[model samples]
Target: MANQSKIKVCVAGATGWAGSELAKAIAVSGELELVAAISRQHAGKSLNEVLDIAGTKIPVFATIEEALTVPCDVLVEYTKPGVAKHHILTAIAKGVNVVVGTSGLSDEDYEEIGIKAAAHQQSVLAVGNFAISVVLLNKFAEMAARYMSNWEIIDYASAGKIDAPSGSARELAYRLSQVKKQELQVSMEHTQGVKETRGADINGTRVHSLRLPGFVISLEAIFGMPDEKLTLKHEAGNSSKPYVTGAFLAIKKVGSFTGLKRGLDSVID
Candidate 1:
């Protein structure tokens, strides 16, 4: 890519752990440029000060409205669920494409966003987990759903994670439900134990979430058969590098779309 053709990007939540990594990755990449960094807590500080990018003078703004004053090709959001919907809609209204890395948003949320993006002639790409392995995991689970009669999703995250079921697990359950209806050994209505013990019902699949210390983020899709069991799991490390490449790919491809697209697999050929 030519220097003049680089994609100018504004990053919301630039001071956060994942956001900082994304900012640095954009700054160092020849295909992308960090034009603005948004963080209410770090407002008035230079990107160099907040992100420690020596000599770079990108300004940090307290709000998306202020950040939009700068020219940008894309807005990469890594904020919380509470604000992600507004941020994405604001960007679309401003004629900017978006790549959303935030979790906890429901399918209804994306449906509304897609409508807005289509009306505005912009694009929004939201991914539950950007790791390539996780994308493959989802694909494999979809394939397994066709053959297996019973399966459940288990999502593991750190205690600090607020969402009950991790986004990855939700995405997997949704996709699997579309492919096959889970055959439960015991129906929820007939179960004797506490209903909560059966886990949350997503579509037709049971999704169990676990939050505890010493766990980063992980997910498992377990399938049960008459004589054997199959388990597919993916565990993420503490670092955020696994997400960077996938995010960059989303940024590059989002322009080709007219509305919201979910999952990294959407961009993978």
Candidate 2:
């Protein structure tokens, strides 16, 4: 086994919110070394220039091929969902493990990635929501599902977020569905007159999405009983530190995992 201190990393989407923060985290983390960064728009800029972190002047490349020139053991993907799949696939094909944070990627996308990972003997891990509190929210939802059957998820993100029923919400619905005994209310059917008024329905659970400017990422798992309601909520503020820590954990752990692993909880103890 290689020494832990020698692990090298590449950060894709180095200029974006999560990517830049993750790059900064990698720069500060003593266990891992930042070897490359990829961002089409930010190419030619140094890592220090793009992330505002001094000392390392690693050249940024606009394409993955260019960035791959740098020696790296893992790739941390923070690009959009569509872009992320390609990056992860490419990394795995080249024997580089991946820790993906971009949302909106579907199960089919992951299944394909799994095939590639198994063929190459590389690791691929995807996280819908990286915030530790959000991780706990999913954990608690799984536990709550065992006792309750009537539940719905409300997923909230900024207005600019393109995906409907945000990844976290979909994951929660999927996890809850695994344990939920009774089917949930189908709220979409009753609101036929106004389609926008209704949110996306998952299995039997109705997942309502709120896209507004002030919100970062937030979710509420509402469970109902004969007369009472239980709400498990997780709110993420503007800070990217929480997500960065989780991303770091995922990147560090992916290599040890032999195949495709889904969700941040898989890596978390």
Candidate 3:
């Protein structure tokens, strides 16, 4: 059995945007050791050269399978949405806990992962959006949902982002669903033929997705009443560094979780 005192960690998609940042965070974390790093394009490179850390030569493998050749207590995934599920399942099947920051996983996907984790008695912690601002925004949005009705969400991101409406929007939708039922009234009085701008429907909330070149992730929950309207919004910039601390916290806490857990709020006080 691996010593619980120090967790040996492996990072998947280690050369990508968030992956690189997670590598750097784990390298300096002290409590977790960077045992292996996986990046198909940058295999065999030293971690020092890949992330420019001094005196560290943790070798990078071309794939997670190769990285798994070495022992690890946990697997941290920062890969794209399409690949995240497989990586997480692989890690859980291998008896390693997981800390996931990858986006785009559906609720059913998470449920399936939860079932697998429960059967194996393993732990899987997934975060749709790891930034603290996003977490607080979700909290505020849920609170607003409790008091406000006829609310809608507008989710914005870069054009290159694969998923529409975002995982964050879906998370917000799930949270709002838990708080209360929001009744949406669509105005039947249509002006000329402007119909397509109504946005997508998630559960019961209307979620509109905006993808532009300069936009980082941004989401606004707008609520309207008889005389007043309230707006709750959150914006994220280029650097994903804000998510590092939350991801680290998830890594430390996931080991205690018995099955799949969603959202940073679940594990955090």
Best candidate, lDDT: 1
Candidate 3 displacement at residue 22 in angstroms? 1.9
Candidate 2 off by > 4 Å: 1-4, 180-182, 185-198
For residue 146, give model 3's deviation from the true position in Å: 1.1
Clashes of each: 0, 0, 0
Candidate 1 per-residue lDDT, tens place, 122-146, comes to 9999888888999999988888888
Ranking by lDDT: 1, 3, 2
Q: Residues 190-264, candidate 3: write the lDDT tens digits.
A: 524765577766877778899999998898989888899999889988897887888788888898879988888
Superposed Cα deviation of residue 142, candidate 1 (Å): 0.9
Candidate 3 similarity to native, TM-score: 0.91
lDDT of 1: 0.89
Model 2, position 147: C-alpha lDDT score? 83
Provide the TM-score for each candidate, comma-separated: 0.96, 0.91, 0.91
For residues 127-238, write the lDDT of model 2, one tens digit per residue. 8888989899989888887887577788989999998877788777777766754653544556558775555567556779999999988999988888888999999888
TM-score: which is higher, 1 or 2? 1
Worst 10 residues of 1 by lDDT: 47-56
| Top candidate when judged by TM-score against the true structure | 1
Two-way lDDT contest, 2 vs 3, winner: 3
The C-alpha lDDT values of all candidates are 0.89, 0.82, 0.83
